[model samples]
Target chain A: MARQQRGIRTRRTILEAAGAVFDEHGYAATTIAMVLERAEVTKGALYFHFPSKESLARAVLAERPPLETVPVRPCKLQEMVDVTFVLACRLLDDPLLKGGVRLAVDQCAPQSVDHAGLFRRWADHLTWLLRQAREQGELLPSVDPRETVEMLVGSLAGIQLMSRALTERADLAHRVAVMWSHVLPSIAVPGLLPRIDAASDRGSRVTEDLG
Target chain B: MARQQRGIRTRRTILEAAGAVFDEHGYAATTIAMVLERAEVTKGALYFHFPSKESLARAVLAERPPLETVPVRPCKLQEMVDVTFVLACRLLDDPLLKGGVRLAVDQCAPQSVDHAGLFRRWADHLTWLLRQAREQGELLPSVDPRETVEMLVGSLAGIQLMSRALTERADLAHRVAVMWSHVLPSIAVPGLLPRIDAASDRGSRVTEDLG
Candidate 1:
């Protein structure tokens, strides 16, 4: 059991290292030698864990920590929206995840449907959440849930891309939350506006106090 | 005078050739030698027209076709919008320009500010049009012009990105016109919806019959 545990740890280490390398050097430029060098593992050991570079890259791109490992739990629509907001904020804060995002946005070829498919996954995730929002009476009946999700994700991605250009991390999260507050209400149910508005007021006050 | 005219023609040839090479090979991967070979011009001739690779690239990105070349006059805001719509359709149809767009998007790097600046130029162009729309009383009085412009541009670009993923042509202008029919009513002057609805109907017919 101890030997098995050590083997798993080594495998995880190699995967993370490969992710970083690919994100930096791109898939075409990254090499197995670089991965082995970063992981401080022999070629044989690396081969023992992964058969090929393509498989390794797929692992990195597809890596997801199980929900049970995180504090996240299934919840109501409003709660899911709140959780999604927090998760998006957390994703912006995570160092390892940032490279993957940059790779997807700036490096991935639009001509490659496989790469585009990877992006559609994020849209799919947002679609699922939007459907929940609709079911919970949190959204307007006239709203096309798919388009709302698209606008939300696409606008946030655009905002993050712009923020990354600004080269300043100061107050990014607060600004993003405020932006979300303004955007969220567009599709949200009219009756819930007061609750969302009050929450947004508090957010703005916090922003002012932070300044 | 004759020699000067010849110089202008040579410069245009070099720029066109350079744009093609850059679109095919991308920025980092493309070499001066490759550009020279493709243009059938010597290094001296290439340098005479453009001093450096960076300057050449900036020219390729910054190239704007003559406004007079477009079909519609831009004197009135409505005419300006019509002209802009026509140009947007033409841009997606042009093979060479589409290639340049591919090059521009694919060349984007997280560390690079140039690509962001390019998108800023796009936003700036759209903002200018929206300001014209406001002056003409086409926009709602309560709308924050900048935010409206951002959403319109963001949504159009997002749609184009998705469309390009699915199809060969980047024909987003008509779809945007359709979207604007619904979206403009939300943010346009009360009486403006009929005009927009007509435009939307026209665009849909164009897509159905032509596309």
Candidate 2:
């Protein structure tokens, strides 16, 4: 068990180092030697966990940290906002998330892996939340959950990308709040509007609460 | 003057070929030789027009085709929708626009050129249109034109990208129309909402009318 734990720790360290390198240089420009150097691990050790750069990228892409951290809330709409906010906050600091998003959207490395899976997961989660919101009478009757899910996913992706391009995502949480402000009015029922906190600070608050 | 015109035509041909190649293989994988093969131009001819691959990518990034084509409409809101629709249609078939967007968003080639110019131009134009809409009493008094412009530009980019990734942008017009449908209700005045045509077919109709 001790040996297994050590192996896990070493694997995690490699993944984190790889994430940072991938975030900086992107997929094609990134190399295993860079990851090994950053990780300060022997080539054999690094290869034991991740055999190739593609697998490392796939591992980085598969890291969905924010999803595991968001605590459930009574108001589904609030939970949805919290999810986006928390993700935005994580994206700001987490190399893994940043690298994953870059790899997923960057058209340079199409053969790496199925980047669409991340988007599909996000859409599915948002759809489930929207269904819950609809059941709770938080959403307007005219809202199509699926369409709204796509818009939410797509718009957030764009906002994050633009923010990253312009400011390296420094104001991502704020931009996401602005996006929700523009979007909520069109989809949320009037009764729920005042209750849902879509503030820029919500992410920090949620992060603290989760901690 | 005739020699200069011929030079311009050759440059245009090289740019078009470069755009198609960049759209397919992205900036990193693309080569001058691939472009030469695609354009069927000699090394001397290609070099005479574009100094390097970076210059060709920059030229493709600098290509602003949609702005020149969208005619002014009496209703500013209609014109805004028309701009997006026309852009969506053009994006469906135009390699220049596709490659430009790809290069603009791909962070892999950060040192190549500043690709944010295209996004800024789009936002500036949208803001101008929103201002006109405000003056004509077509927009909600509460709407912030700048914020809406960013959202419009960012969301459209995201939508087009998602469409491209999922379906090779086959349904970009429909997706863009859906975007406007969601956005128009929040920004447009109630009276103008019914008049604004955000239909999928509006792109083809507007394209024909413009021609």
Q: Which parts of model 1 are misplaced by more than 4 Å?
A: A21-53, A65-84, A106-113, A136-142, A168-186, A194-211, B33-44, B65-88, B95-100, B103-113, B132-143, B147-158, B169-171, B174-186, B189-194, B197-211
Query: Against the true two-chain complex, what DockQ does each candidate achieve?
Result: 0.27, 0.70
Error of 1 at B42 (Å): 5.0
Candidate 1, A54-161: lDDT as tens digits: 667666656652211222324333443453344344454443355355445543432331544445666676677678777777876767766655555544554544
Deviation in Å, model 2, residue A142 alpha carbon: 1.6
B36-76 per-residue lDDT for model 1 (tens digits): 88788879989998887777776666666322343332333
Find the candidate with the highest DockQ and give its number: 2
Candidate 1 chain A, run of 10 with poorest lDDT: A65-74
Q: List, residue by residue over A172-197, the lDDT tens digit for candidate 2.
A: 88888878877888888987788889
Chain A agreement with the truth for model 2, given as TM-score: 0.96
lDDT accuracy of residue A120 in candidate 1: 64
